[model samples]
Target: GAGVSQSPSNKVTEKGKDVELRCDPISGHTALYWYRQSLGQGLEFLIYFQGNSAPDKSGLPSDRFSAERTGGSVSTLTIQRTQQEDSAVYLCASSHGGTDYGYTFGSGTRLTVV
Candidate 1:
């Protein structure tokens, strides 16, 4: 049972730069979500993907932010033109998208935009 995984758990970048955060969801799960948590704040949904199609991108902060999933398992969030306010923990979760299943989250990619 492979769980979710993320790379570069800690990331530091300069303003106006581009950064990519990766996520590996559990096998057999069809639903994946990306959420961002700011300091002392609650989690904010960024995007959601079911299988290979994304039905929700409304949560993405701006056009500068985007994400994609391949093979219905791995996902990557790309931040274009990073800003200081973008510094936060980006969390990835996957589940069966049913009443009984719970989302499993990765440790998260902490982005520090300076």
Candidate 2:
């Protein structure tokens, strides 16, 4: 894909269920990020992957949240034991690896935990 892509635009799951969100970054992009945004709330950084460096997991809210980038391209975010508080739009973004480069964001996956 020429731009960042995410799958299953919307998902509704029961509490305690697990969900996996996928992200396909633009070709050649070296930076990928995952963020969560609750209704009427601001974006919260979840994780970040850059080139061959170790992934930055500092932003993850809990051990149940995890993510991985494969071949420096596609990435997946997994949420275990979904909770009502975890309901939010998960956004994925890719960039060319610098502050000067603008990011291309996916439409985001809306997760609703009930």
Candidate 3:
């Protein structure tokens, strides 16, 4: 994909179920990030991967939230045992490196819990 790509632009799942979201970053980008946004709330950083080194996993909300980047290109975010409070827009973003470059974001996967 030329730009960031996210699957299942929208997802509706019952509480307690697990869901996985995918992200495809731009070609050659080494910095990948995930964020969660709730109504009236600004973007919350979830995690970041720089190259093939250890990712900056400082923003994951909980143990249930996890992500991985393979080939330093595509990535996936998995939310285990969803909760109603977990409903939000899961956004994926990527930058050229880690030096504050402009980030390109995915359209996002809107997850609705019930």
Compute each candidate's TM-score over C-alphas: 0.94, 0.96, 0.95
Return whichever of 1 and 2 wins on TM-score.
2
- The per-residue C-alpha lDDT of model 2 at residue 112 equals 95
How high a TM-score does candidate 3 get? 0.95
After superposition, candidate 3 runs with Cα above 4 Å error: 98-100
Candidate 1: list runs displaced more than 4 Å: none
Return the top candidate by lDDT. Answer: 2
Ten contiguous residues minimizing lDDT sum, candidate 2: 94-103
Instruction: List the pairs of residues colliding in candidate 1.
Output: none
Between the candidate structures 1 and 3, which one is better when assessed by lDDT?
3
* lDDT digits (tens) for residues 1-114 of candidate 2: 777899989999999999999999999889999999999999999999999999999999999999999999999999999999999999999999876467899999999999
lDDT of each: 0.91, 0.94, 0.93
Give the backbone clash total of model 1. 0
Identify the leading candidate in terms of TM-score.
2
Report the Cα lDDT for residue 29, model 2: 89
Mind giving the per-residue lDDT tens digits that candidate 1 earns over 21-64?
Answer: 99999888889999999999999999999865645999998999
What CA root-mean-square deviation does each model show from the true structure? Answer: 1.3, 1.0, 1.2
Deviation in Å, model 3, residue 49 alpha carbon: 0.3
